[model samples]
Target: MRLLLVEDDEHVAAALLAVLKRHGFTAGLARNGAEAIEKTQAGGFDVVLLDLGLPDADGFEVYGQIRRLSRIPVIMVTARADVRSRIHGLNLGADDYVVKPYDTGELLARIHAVSRRAALDQASSDGPASGGTGGAPAPGGQVLTAGPVTVELSTRRVLVDGARVELTRKEFDLLALLAQRPGVVFRREQIISDVWRTSWEGTGRTLEVHVASLRSKLRRPELVETVRGVGYRLAVPPAL
Candidate 1:
C-alpha cells in the first residue's frame, strides 16, 4: 500500500521507512505540516502515519487541513500516551492511533486494518440507493432498529428518535455490532476481535471509552448494559 509518513525526526523516519519498505509498502516522508498537507492534496496515498510533533505546525492542525483535502485514512503515531490526547485524535476522525515505542507487528496490523476499513466504507458510499429513493442502500446490509434508534449500515448513518446522531467510526461499529444482536452479551475479547480486529493490551480500555462515548451521544445510558465481570450488551428497548 502507498503510505504517507509525516514525522520531522530524520532518524525516526529513516528507521520506520526501512521497516515499511521491508514490509512491501511504498511510503513517502513529510518532515512538517505544510509538506504533509501538500502531499495529501496531491492524493495518491492510501493511509497517513501522522506524528504530533511537527517542526513547522501542530499535528492536529495539519490533520484538519488534510481532512479538508482528502478522505485518506490517517493513523496517529506519536509518544503522547495520555487518554486526553488519544481521545482528541480519535475525535478528529482519525482512523487509529499508535503510541510511540510501539511494536512493529502491531503497527503493521493497524495499517492494514485501517486501510481495509476505508475500502469497505468507500464501497458502501459508492453503492446504489435503496427503494429507488435518493437514500443510501445496502444490498447485504441491514437497517437495525431498537426503540427510537435506527442504524443504516449502508450509509453509516444513525438516527435517535428521528434526530440524526453523529458518531465516530469506532463508535458506530461498536453500536452496530451490538445492535445486530440486542440483549446478547458480547465478550470483551470477542468485541475487540470483531471490531478492532487486533489483539492488543490497550484495546479493552479503548472499548470502554467507546461505550461511554456511545451512551453519551445516544443520550441513553441504559441503552448499553455492562454485565458484572463480563463484557457488555445492548439493552432491548421497551415497545412504545
Candidate 2:
C-alpha cells in the first residue's frame, strides 16, 4: 500500500519508514501539516499516518482538510493518550488513533484494519443502494426512522426532528443497525461482529462510547434502550 507518514520528527519518521518498507509498503514522508495536506491533495497514498504535533498546523486541522478533499483513511499517531483527544480525533474523521510508545505490531494491525474498513466503505458506496450486507435492509424504504431521527441508508444521512445531524462513521453504523429493527434487542456480541467486525472482548468499550455519542448526537438518549445483560434496542416512539 502507498502510505503517507506525517511526522515532524525525522528520527521517528525514519524508523517508521524503515518498518513500513520492511513490511512491503510504499511510503512517503510529510514533515508538517501543510506538506501532508499538499501531498494528500496530490493524490497517491492509500492510508495516512498523521502525527497531531505538526509544525505548521495542528494535526486535527490537517485531518479536517484531508477529509474535505478525500475519503482516504487516516490514523492519528500522537502522544496524546487521553480519552478526550482520542474521541476528538475519531470525531474529526480519523479511522484510528495510535498513541505514542505504540507497539509496532499493533500499529501495523491498525493500519491494515483501517485500510480494510475504507475499502469496504468504497465498495459499498460504489455498489447497490442497499448498503453493506451487515444487517437487514431498511424494509420498503431507504430511510429508517425511530422517534424523531431519520436515517437514509443509501446516502448515509441522518436527520433528527427535521434538523440534519452529523454523526461519525461508527456512530451512524451503530444507529443504523439498531434502527433496522426498532424495539428488537440486539446482542452486544452481534453488534460488535456486525458493525466493528471484531469480537466483543476487546472492543466493548468502543461500542459503549459510540452508543453514548449516538445518543448525544440524536438528542434522544431513550430512543436506544439498554437491555441490561443482553445488549441494546431502538425504542420506536409512539406515533403522534
Candidate 3:
C-alpha cells in the first residue's frame, strides 16, 4: 500500500518510515503541510498520516485542502491529546486520530482500518448498481429520505428541507449508515465495526459524539432515538 507520512519531526518520521516500509508500504514523507498538499495533488497515495503542528500550516488546514481535491482517507497524527483537538481533527474529515507517543502497532491497525474503509468506498463507487453502469443499482445506492432530511448515497450529501447541510466526513458516514436502515437499532459496537471496519475498544463515545453532531446538523434532534442499554435507531420507517 502507498501511504503519505506528513510529520516535521525527523526522528519520529524516520522511525515511522521504517515501520511502514517493514510492513510493505511504499511510504512517502512530507516534512510540512505545504509539501503534503503538493504531494497529494500529485496523486497515488492510498492514505495520509498528517501531523497537526506543521511548520507551514495546521493539519486541519491541510485536511480541508485535501478534502477539496479528493476523498482520500487521512489519519491525523499529533501530540495534542485534548478532546477538542481530536474532535476538530475528525470533524475536518480525518478518518482517525492518533496522539503522539502512540504505539506503532496501534497505528498500523488504524492504517489497516482506514485502508479497508477506503477500499469499501472505492468498491461502492465502482458498483454498477450504484449507477456505475451495466449492472443493477447498489444496495447502498438507494436514496434515504426521512421527513425534511434527504441523503443521497452516491454523493454522500445530506440535505435538510432542501437546504444542503454541512457535515464532517465521519458525521456524514455515520448518519448515512443509520439512515440506510431506519428503525433498525444498531449497537455502538456494530456501528464501530461497520462504519469504521474495526473492533471497538470501549470507545463507543466516539460514535455518540458523531451521532450528536449529525442530529445537530440535521436540525431534528429527535430523528435519532437512543435506546437505553442498547444503541441508536433512526426514527424513519423502513419502507420509506
What do the candidate models score in CA lDDT, each in turn? 0.83, 0.82, 0.78
Model 3: per-residue Cα lDDT over 57-91, one tens digit each? 87788889988887889999888999999998888
Question: What are the clash counts of all predictions, listed in order?
Answer: 0, 0, 4
Winning model by lDDT: 1
lDDT (10s digit) by residue, model 2, range 147-221 = 787877666778778787899988888888777557877678778776887766889899998999888888888
Whichever of 1 and 2 has more lDDT, that candidate is 1
Residue 132, model 1: lDDT of 33
Q: Between prediction 1 and prediction 3, which has the larger lDDT? A: 1
* 170: Cα error in model 2, Å: 22
Task: State which candidate, 2 or 3, has the greater lDDT.
Answer: 2
Tell me the tens digit of each residue's lDDT in model 1 across 1-240.
799999999999999999988756789999999999999999889999999999889889999999999989999988999999999999999999999999886677677667757756764775555443234434544477877778777677888888889999999988887775577676676677668886746788899899999999999889989988767888977786
What C-alpha lDDT, on a 0 to 100 scale, does residue 192 get in candidate 3?
79
Backbone clash pairs for candidate 3 read 129-136, 129-137, 129-138, 130-138
Off by over 4 Å in 3: 130-240
For model 1, the superposed segments whose C-alpha errors exceed 4 Å read 130-240
Error of 1 at 32 (Å): 0.6
Worst ten in a row by lDDT for model 2: 131-140
